[model samples]
Target chain A: MAMTEMRKDDDTALDLFFAEARQSAPEPSAVFLGRILAQAEGVQAGFCATPVQPAVRRGVRAGGLGMLLALLGGWGGIGGMATAAVAGVWIGFAGSDTVAQVAGYAMTTETATASALLADGDILALAAE
Target chain B: MALDALDDVSDETLLVLYGNGDRAAARMLTLRMGPLAFRVAQRMLGDRAEAEDLAQEALLRLWKIAPEWRTGEAKVTTWLYRVVTNLATDRLRRRRGIGLDEAPELPDGAASAVEQMIDGDRAAALEAALAQLPARQRQAVVLRHLEGLSNPEISAAMEIGVEAVESLTARGKRALAAILAGRREELGYGHD
Candidate 1:
């Protein structure tokens, strides 16, 4: 009975001690709050800036490359036309035997032109794909 | 969404908004969780500067992870509590062999003027007694009594069983009582 009474007294004192102790929760310093707020703002800033970048970069690069290829292909077509005109004159000045050879050469050149067209066709195919 | 609208949203929702570049959400979460991080760190570490630094680091980590915060995996405060606890433990390990003779003073913000006038000595005595406790017991008791966390919350924070938390708290209280018994005259509780 005496031991139980002593235990009760101890419990009461402990409760009172803790009750008084708990009255003081330390307030966070202003400097700490400021640092954390600054960091949160920094993160929020990154989230705002990231999403629109990659798509814009891809669009600009692909468009520029396509424009350059079109300009180069147009310049190369002038050279090909001039070569065809020269071949026509040479065939006219030569005989029927030369004509056959010239015709054969023209056929071979046409095949090469056809293959070149096929390569251009591949660019369109790639775009579609 | 309006700040008024955000007041009703959960922490996970706030983090999602924070990831979506919502400044209000970040502000709200900072206002809510920053003090919590500070309070826990201050109590556990018992040093003003170290607690402040730990709290800052914890909040900084929270910001870095906001973009990838899993929606429902864990509560926001729960995750931060674990981080702060681990940081405090790491600091304590680095500070091994130091005695707790110089207990840090608790802030007077939560104490009313009446409390300071009437019970300042008792409060100081209690803090000194708390310093003498083993770290684990001190943490358990502080979380249970001073911080008013539930046994389950203490278990999660301490990563221990609920039974273990209860045992620590009990033994810690007994030890506190015995220590304070020696200074009842100064503590103003006259001995029989």
Candidate 2:
């Protein structure tokens, strides 16, 4: 009975102490919620991708494409080699444009078209229309 | 142990449930402990934006660890508080290299003078008092009083012994009360 009474008293004191302390201040606003959620999303994405192998997926897709391209080249001879060389150069240039766009989006203003398309053609076509 | 009688379950149990993919447990734990965690981070860092981020990060980490959480170990909330405290300390350390700025003042509310007067600058005063304490002392005060943890629980949270918790809480409270009490007349806190 005495132990129980002591426990009750201890609980009461703890309650009162916290009650007084909780009167300190209010919480952050909904704006703060948006900020934290954005951060949480970034952290979650990083955690989710940690153990997954992007290389495996890329390897499977690339292997199939390589096999098909090799078959077409073998059948077409010189024409096929020319086509493949042109395609590779064109792809390299296209990849460069894409990398520029992404880097621009991350480092600078995404809305800036000049930065979004450092290469001449993509924006020139957009402008022509 | 009584389900119906459980006003609030400890963070450890909530953690175990959340780890097991109990969405209800996760939500309950967040709502139950979010305010306390946020307050502790805010008090320690003196920056609302950073504090909010730190609190969310701490909780997210808790969620990530839930799947592997062991029972009969440290209380979940204590672990969370420790994470928050450590994160806040890191922010402070980083700020030292990058010159920490004064916290931006919050916008004033549209309440009447009486209401404003009652709430007038109390938050500001509390923030100032919190800024004056050492990081560990501030954590002790916030954990014991504001966060409502027992000394033993605080020891577990702070990774210190119960006696150390007691010493820190006493010193912290005395310092905080002294700071707040000093501004009582100027801020009109003692009038009512």
Candidate 3:
């Protein structure tokens, strides 16, 4: 029992010592506080200087592209788009097999028409035959 | 809130305000957490100058992270303690161990709220004994006794298991007792 009492006393003493020490803790001087506060302001200013603007800019560009795609998709489905692209390619090519084939077809039709007209013009020959 | 009204705000709130560029919040945090970081660094390092530097460095790091400060992630002071712990550990690694005589005891001859409640030499002796403890044991004892941190809080700061914290504290107290028991009479702790 006496030993237990002694232990309790020691505990109390240690507690008292710690409590006292805590109360005596030193604080930062005014100069130190001033310097650190200044540093904080500088840092905050650097951080606040449009830090999120990059993400905002990126979002805006993405939104613009998305709108353009939506409009294009609304105007033409995939098959219609493919047809328009082929027609456009045919019209645009100044020197290509596609252009040569179109020209050749038009010439052949014209030559056939001329031949038929000449045959019709042979009225005497037909009479003789 | 105004600058003068920052006393009522919590550390995390103050950090948020600081993040938002309120100089008042910075002042409030410096006034509040500065002393905590300083005292712990001083106790661990046994050098007031280096302690002040460490405290300032720790708080500066805190300020830098303020913009990313996540509320309820952890208490501001707990984070500060961990910073100080790492800073002091780095410092201790760079220097040889200085004995109890070098331990930063309380300022000589100034009465404080708790100083009046306890005998002064006994407290000084306790600091000396605490200095004699191994670094980890000393940290556990200081956090548990002087700072009055819970074991879980200590575990977080020390980055150890709760059981490990308990064991360290127990061992630290035993070491302190062995070191101080012989001088109980001389230190005026003999009445008990």
Q: What's model 3's lDDT at A111?
A: 80
Better of 2 and 3 by TM-score: 3
Better model by DockQ, 1 or 2? Answer: 1
Q: What is the interface RMSD of candidate 1, in Å?
A: 2.0
Q: Which prediction has the highest lDDT against the true structure?
A: 1
What's the C-alpha lDDT at position A104 in model 3? 97
lDDT, residue A86, model 1: 93
Off by over 4 Å in 1: A1-3, A51-129, B98-120
- Candidate 1 chain B minimal-lDDT segment of 10 residues: B105-114
Error of 1 at B63 (Å): 1.7
Give the per-residue lDDT of model 2 (tens digit) for B99-135. Answer: 2233221112211221333444656556565565556
State the fnat of model 1.
0.83
Give the candidate order by descending lDDT: 1, 3, 2
Which prediction has the highest TM-score against the true structure?
3
Ranking by DockQ: 1, 3, 2
Output DockQ, candidate 2: 0.09
lDDT of 3 by residue, A13-120 (tens): 566666766776556677766776677777778766864643444323356666775666744565689898998886886567768888999999998786677665
* Model 2 agreement with the true structure over A27-109: per-residue lDDT tens digits: 86766555544544444445445476545443234566667755665446658688889988977978888867878787666
Question: Which candidate number maximizes DockQ?
Answer: 1
